[model samples]
Target: MFFNRKNLEDHDLRHFYKKLLFPRLVEERMLTLLRQGKIGKWFSGIGQEAIAVGSTLALEDDEYILPMHRNLGVFTTRGIPLSRLAGQWVGKDSGFTKGRDRSFHFGSQEHKIIGMISHLGPQLAVADGIALAHKLKKENKVTLVYTGEGATSEGDFHEALNLASVWELPVIFLVENNGYGLSTPVSEQYRCANLVDRAVGYGMEGILIDGNNILEVYNAIDTIAQSIRQKPRPVLVECKTFRMRGHEEASGVKYVPPHLFDQWSALDPLLNFEKFLLKAQIFSDIEIQQIKTEQKAIVEQEISSAFIETEIQADIQRELNDVYASSVYTSKNNGPSKENSKRYIDTISDALNLAMERNDNLILMGQDIAEYGGAFKITDGFVAKFGKERIRNTPICESAIVGAALGLSINGYKSVVEMQFADFVSCGFNQIINNLAKTHYRWGEKADTVIRMPTGAGTGAGPFHSQSNEAWFTKTPGLKVVYPAFPDDAKGLLLAAIDDPNPVLYFEHKYLYRSLTGNCPEDYFHTEIGKARLVHEGDQCSIITYGLGVHWAIEFQEQHPEYSIDILDLRSLQPWDKQAVETTVEKTGRIVILHEDTLTCGFGAELSAYIAEHCFEYLDAPVMRCASLDTPIPMNKLLEDQFLAKARLGSTITKLLAY
Candidate 1:
């Protein structure tokens, strides 16, 4: 063992002095910076330094530390330079996020510490994924993630812990139970007497400890960390402590009763540890004083240096700096598909199997995805062919599943996540929107994975199961949205999306799974993403649509053979073929934007605005939009049909023609 009981139990004076005093130095310097207007807000871990500094001693330099917004001591223990932290606080390009984020909300992939998020619970699941990767690769490393006493109430917290226990992932969850969750007391949050009891239900070991005692925290964490590295299991350690300040420096902290506040202040970890060292004869008073002086001097010097480095001297904007990157694949499709090829679901399954066969780095994760083949039987035979390791049947945890996929992607694997239904995407919204989509732009980390969303209505699944959610992904930057219409495009685009370097939300219309058929090749074929397919070309009017809308527009074309019209199937929504929309609108001198989602703020809105802004002179009439009503999908078939029917769409088209 690199470190063992004797190493820590011996308690050398040098080690004790540094751990006890470093966090204190940081707290004082940060307060100074805040008073000087250099830092805007600070969440100091003044009282809970032991849990941060000592518990982290168990982890190696390479292991990931996913910490909270207030675990500044974790940064100090992990050897994150004080200057770099100061730079981040001051919004310098030299900071961890390159001026994109401030206040502990930053990380270095190189350091393996995930940047803390404002919504903090997601990191627990992300760390579980890293631990899963280590287990798969047979690496002797453990992952540690920290959360607050109150964060246990979050859905993500349970989602992560349950997954960790099921997988026996080598992760340590250090929950800082600091009496109060912001202003609310712990009694109001959970019915349980203690947070440690929650661990037994998940089938994991749990420990409760005094958070202020550095030696006790160090002993418990190091022992558990060693066992996890060898046996690979998660352990929950609850640190009972008190937050020495308000949630943030700007907070008034008026809610804290004066008597109770003084009680905790008297037990301040730093001051208590200092007296302990003196009594134990670990260090004389003058020797301990020297260590404190040296640590304070070092912190002050780093802060002074950071102030100068982060000061504004020139325009900070870098126009050429791209938030994301892309690649253009020249997809060559042979002349035509064989007649009577396959059904929509069959092609999707075939494409996924082929991709998995071709790329060993690819893996599938979702509830019921492995043995059951997913809710729609799309991945039915995958477990036998690929085994349970590659085709994972995750717990019914959407947030954890998606968050884990991001972690696997970061570890150099291409993960494909399946949401049983599109509407369920809302359950895992934080990881998709905040972490997976924005991590690249914020910290230069890539989430190279594909999220398969079974979208669209018509199967009588009602509101929760039926809905087109393309607009949500299209609206978020750094995420690509693809909704394939034909079987050929479905097979081809799925393969392309898997290969893309960014996170791609690939939406497959559930209603068309078996109803639609096309002549697509049996082998691997790539349909270039961000390119539109001109299904039928005409010069009278243009119908711009994708997915189910393609079939609707085709119905319009067949019914009205009198009008020369072009139907464009946009394969990708985020990078929809703008050039194709422009060309078709110019050639026809009229255009209609159509989608199955609600009319307000749909992807159609953006397309309509584009045509209005750029093609105003060429248009013979104002652009028309055909969309579903702004109401929840109904359970009854008649109401759902009335919501948006082909006959009504035809009538709207005829009216547009008359105008």
Candidate 2:
């Protein structure tokens, strides 16, 4: 209640009141919109408005801030028009996402406010990237991230903090402790009673503040931002607040205990602060009511204007607009561009060596990828070719490794993240799916990064090390998925992915690492992404595949020349060449989707559906699919072969031919 702690004056308190009023008005109006069925599903930042307003007020307009879903208050305080916010909520044209992204998913580049994923943890990494970029560009700005206490448990939380501290980045992690994450309570989630203490493990300082006190939140943010500007280190601030409403509009109070809600409801930041202001004689009840009414009127006017002016047209087309930046991928040739008899490993090894040799911004990072030359020896001689700075080894923190790579990627560096085994990618799925996949889209294609993962099931590697889950990202928008089948294709695509402006998940077939050799060009070359290569020409059927399946289809074509089989390998999945696919399907009349992943919801299934929708008229038969049986890859060599598409390929060909 007293300003002695933060040494604030009555005038400062009045400014705080004004700042808090706008955000609260925005939240209340949005809630009204949600209840009135004007806005779709929504989340409220009602009680926690003080923290958002106070923290945002402490920074300059050019400084960066990444707000989570519940930070509508932060958006308002950062100067997002209430009308625009309402438009976004009601799926109107004036929405930040052009009504594409859900309500509360507002982002503004002009305000220096970055967007984040719906899931937890991504904001922390993106904040780190923003800080790192600022550091690299020699810009005197700090990035502040707002997230719920529940997000702290995610691997990206630790990974981002550790990397930020290690690099001495200028970032502040703000945790809004609202007592609940959806239905789960924070007490049951982690052992640490205080979220701020978790920052200690990362060699950073943190504090727990009374979130109800606007002065406290503002002072804490100002102090941390000043320290970062002067010394450039990361810190965490845990604002102990309460969630007055359900997590979202759809959430009922069924999971919320009556007594628990009652207790937290009593200490609601918004109500307590208003009471404090009244008791301190800083403002009268009538004056407070007047301010509230004025704020509400402003929100109503904005919402009305938004409804009248906003046009909600289909902007989902931009969803694929900046998937990969042009300048980064379009470049001059560095290495020889001729076919030489080389293996897959040879092409990849040379590409890594040459890339590092050419660009100082390019870095190779992974477990044992340095001296050990990676698990499959794809990076042999990398450590010797490039020093420790460029070719580095990492701890067994899979999430941390890739998470740090995400930070480094936007730091003006081209980072090649290698996962030792493709199946182990599960450990880094949060970083990949939650962070890398959405960062570019959220930031309007601000992230420049690439990930190299070795995937495929064969050679008795067992379930953990032998699973193809490319579909995980196929369903996720805004990420480039590349699966190369030959040594030549590998070299070309690797260069292309490395040069790509956005993040890419480059999956290399483990079985094709060395087993399938091709005449790889001796020099580096650029390959057109999103274009499928026509390996063989035929009219009977088109065997659609990527990665190693192209070679398999090539072999199948050699043996089945009488059937006139055609082979098409999709190099990039996200911006897949629908034109090439349609053209091929039209020419062949029959199509068979092939991949090493399990048949259930695999890439083949998606391809079948896509072709069926686009090329149904040209199809002579139902779209056929060939893939591994719905079973985990086994450790036994013979069993593994049987579990994969290898044993079923011949039968699948016969079935398609019969159709």
Candidate 3:
């Protein structure tokens, strides 16, 4: 009586009891699969079944549930078969992902699971996106994102919450507070007294529940989820629970303090719910044992069946699935087509403006890129031409900025999002890397999004504004990364990327805005999407470069006419032109890769590796690389110049001559 526990009937208790044991079996079966080397790997959902079941049950079947790796219980409760899930784990034909997804990572559009992003905080933003889609469709469904207490520390989480609250969208941000974010305890991870307090920070309702009590979890969520359906406002419910097992199969428990482990284990949600069921006389010990045995048997049978199943295998050709759903027609711009030689600056602006004109579905968003025309005025007068709907001004919330763009992309709009400064891209790293870069790989959905960021160091904008982080996205798959030094290439490449079906990260060099200008045609001529441009051809040695460094290499070749050097501008970094690179290296017998980013793990290093392995026979010299000093771009002019690869010719020529 003092605890105020609801007097639930045997039927209700049975409902809760059955739901609670589901994830336990899922966990135990997966753990067994891990031991047997059948499942790929995962973070166990052992003691958190009650939280998953209670929260998801409160919503309708059509409502979206964006879960993490640990929410297998949530997905299963929503009616996805253990066999189909097992197929996903074994990467078999019968798996949900057609064997593309690893264990604990499954998505079912029919069940409204929509997506399962393994990375932490990005899902929060994506969940908001699901709600946005529902709102646009005028559907009465809400989106619930299951994240951890630790993910609250991520910027995408804050970005998504703020936007949801601002727009009053139908979204439930549920934080599964299992005491620890992997090895880091919650106490060490967050500064707030409780994660629910974060809800108020974003102007939303904050609900806390006794996560161990399945009934309480259900009751708390049901009330809020009902309110959301009526008015469509967001709510943040923090479920105070614990993970009884280690973080994952690979994680060791030696690091967790002994006392913390003992305390959390005692409150294990699954066992507590089972005990509650037994005490209420809803089910006898025999029935409970029978249920457990049945669940285990079912899990085992599903695992065995997955080994023999075939329909679930993901189409490997699925990789070629979502490139340009609608036929996008390209037209040569009379304003800047190749026939008429116009000023380079005018051509660059014409290229972007024309691409947006050709496709009404294209939307441009960024800071100050609207009215002020951008810092370099690349987007000057775009707002006036396109109006706010097509060319919108976004809040300086970089994470939300990109997250919103991704949402728009997923919803059938081709978005051209700009970053005022590329250095600040780190603020939205979670969205770019975890969400944008892995959308196609992790989920079957394609992200036809484009991001344009100003890069390079010569402007003296200081440490915060001037930096090159292209190598960051270069390491990630499912992203088309490009760096253009010339205006013609920039215009053509930007058009091609906007037309491509995947996410593209276009890096614009700040120094190249007006440094070097070339006449560009008025007609719409696309430099092939993954094609590189040979700026200048020679025979003495080959200089491979991109971004602002390409111009520098061209100027260097002109000054030294005696040395016949070939300059290959790698416009597209992801699917770089290997044939062009090999031919140049073979003809010259010497190669030097150059870029504006730091020397350590730069794109230049990646090119050097390619040459070392593939073009070893054609090379008469060891591949050399000229890049920025391995340090942060300093503010001072001398330091910036020294760090900007300004002496590309002196360094690369010397190395080539020596070779």
Q: In lDDT terms, which candidate is top? A: 1
lDDT preference between candidates 1 and 2, better one:
1
Q: RMSD of model 2, in Å?
A: 4.2
Residue-pair clashes, model 3: 19
For candidate 2, the TM-score is 0.83
lDDT of 2 by residue, 1-659 (tens): 44443577888787778778787777777677778887677677777887888898889888878888777767877778777777776767667765557765545768877666676676686677667667756777888888888888777788778877876889998999988888898878788879888888888998899886777888888888887898889998899988777888789657777997777778666677777878889899899999888887888898888778736555555656644455444534655456688888778877777777777778787888888888878777777767766677776667766666665665556788888877778888877776676655544544466778788876678988878878888887667888888888788888887777777888888878778777876766767678888888888898989876777788877777688987888988877889889998999888888888889999888888888887889999888888888987889988888887867788888997897
Q: Residue-wise lDDT of candidate 3 within 1-659, one digit each (tens)?
A: 01224655668667766767876777777787678876557788776777888777777887778788777767777888877777777777666555565765545667877555666777677676567656655777778888899888877788788878876779988899988888898879988889998787888989888776666777787778878887988999998887777788788677678887678777777777777667767678999899989988887788788877755434546655432232243544555434455544566678789888898778787777778887678889888888766676666778877776666666556778888888888888878887777666665666777888788778887778888888898878778888877777778878878887788888887777766667665667676766788889888888898887887887887778877889998888986898989889889989988888888899888889988998889888888888888888889988888887765557668877786
Name model 1 segments beyond 4 Å from true. 1-13, 310-321, 325-340
Best candidate per TM-score, number? 1
Give Cα distance to truth, residue 343, candidate 3, Å: 5.5
Worst 10 residues of 1 by lDDT: 1-10
Would you list the C-alpha lDDT of every candidate in the order shown?
0.84, 0.78, 0.77
* Reference-based TM-score, model 1: 0.94
Rank order by TM-score, top first?
1, 2, 3
